[model samples]
Target: MAEPAPRGITSADLEAVPAPLVAEILDGVLETHPRPRHAMAAGELAGELIPPFAPPFARGRGGPGGWVFMIEPELHFGPQVVVPDLAGWRRGRLPAEPATPFVETPPDWACAILSPSKARLDRGPKRRIYAEAGVAHLWLLDPADGELEAFALTEGRWLLVGTVRRGEMVALAPYDAVPFPLDALFPLDAPAAPTET
Candidate 1:
């Protein structure tokens, strides 16, 4: 007799699936769905992905810069599909090109931009997922507040390195030379009005 399909693996079954299977479904949905608002912020940050300038760095063959990717992975945290605004993987670890929307690999760094619809996810469970996945760095950009919070994983704990507000220039880890002004991440073009003018 033929061997039975692995426990809960099935074309129609949506419940109690394996990790890889869930990853595949998540990738498919993100690819077909319309891009979210956070995509713009992610795109802007992509311009900053460059060579690492710090010592003791693990460089990839593609050069000093790693591969930055935007992924929507189906994390088995709860009931929802938490798609991060942006994610990056070391160049050597990146999946082959044309591998559909969601790559089954955890990114080296993950970024989540807070929008009206996604504030809770970005700040809560999604943050936990990145940490659990052992993401080396994470950036949480709040466009509305015009702030960017950078975190690094040290000894498996997320440590807040910097909280950048308007006019503050923050340096990111793993790529020390790529300095970014906090104001650039915000969408506002004009400064807040002066008090008591």
Candidate 2:
């Protein structure tokens, strides 16, 4: 006889998780992990993008100001509930205030600040889910490695568009309106990564 199928999971299961721990459902399973000690890149990334791309008062700032950003917004794409480190929506797509605390409409861009425990899940299941939901862009910012990887959804898959390491300035697609330095997102005093032969 075939083995018994596991029961389906839901958002309520995530709500039941205790405080200080983050919960997410992946591939029909509810998983929880302790939050990262520091999300420096996530914080710094918001600093860089919001001033230029985000709205309400960005119009006169000299940067293209037609996007709206949120930090750690709970996004529901079908039964999957994902909270990206940072997410953005073009103003035209989200012209008005959202009706609920969580958003069901997919974002134009989503960036994940990868922690040790969540890296595998973000790069695997979560990435797949984003592609399946037709998210236009995805970025992975690894603070430990001081690197940022940008991907575009092309032909129903993620195609890596660019990678910028510490101290480099980049102007990448979808958000190529303004160039920013990668150094701004990583700490100046962090130890250098090991070099490969």
Candidate 3:
């Protein structure tokens, strides 16, 4: 007789995992990655955008203030759960903060900072999940090589919006209102540009 099929992972399995190891349910499988001690300029990117795009500041700081930003938010999309480095939702769409442990509503925009161990998941399964969830924008940033790629969901697929390299000023959507130097988000010794990895 043939062997029985394996059971799928569930939320309980994800929640039972120990701390310091970040976990997510990707395509029905429980996935975990080390929580880095440092965010490597990811925080800088948020610092630059939050003051202008998210509230308590925004319009007061001469920016289009209608966004709510989250860092490493556990987002649930049906049976799939994945966390992005940074995620944003338009204030109108998420007028009030969610009262639950995880956010079920998809973000308007999501960004991932490529990590050697997690790149495959970020570029593949996560991308498909985001597209399937109707996320409007996606950004992939490689700080080691200094590159940022912007993508927009179109016709149920992702369309390459643009790629801003180190030393270049970026005005990419959906927060294009404030143009900032891509170099500011990388260290002084970062490589020139980058190629898809």
lDDT of 1 by residue, 1-197 (tens): 11223443433343444433222123122211224465555665654553342112326323354454545543332222445666677667764543543355666777877776656556765676677777789888887787788899888788999787766666777555567565555444554333341
**Model 1 pairs in collision:** none
> Which 10-residue window in model 3 sums to the lowest lDDT?
1-10
Which residue ranges in model 2 land beyond 4 Å of their true spot? 1-10, 188-197
Q: Give the RMSD in angstroms, all C-alphas superposed, for model 2.
A: 4.3
| Residue ranges of candidate 3 with Cα displaced over 4 Å | 1-9, 187-197
TM-scores, each model vs. reference: 0.64, 0.88, 0.89
lDDT of 3: 0.85
Best prediction by TM-score:
3
Pairs of residues at least 3 apart in sequence or in different chains that clash in candidate 3: none
> What are the Cα lDDT values of the candidates?
0.57, 0.81, 0.85
The Cα error of candidate 3 at residue 182, in Å, is 0.7
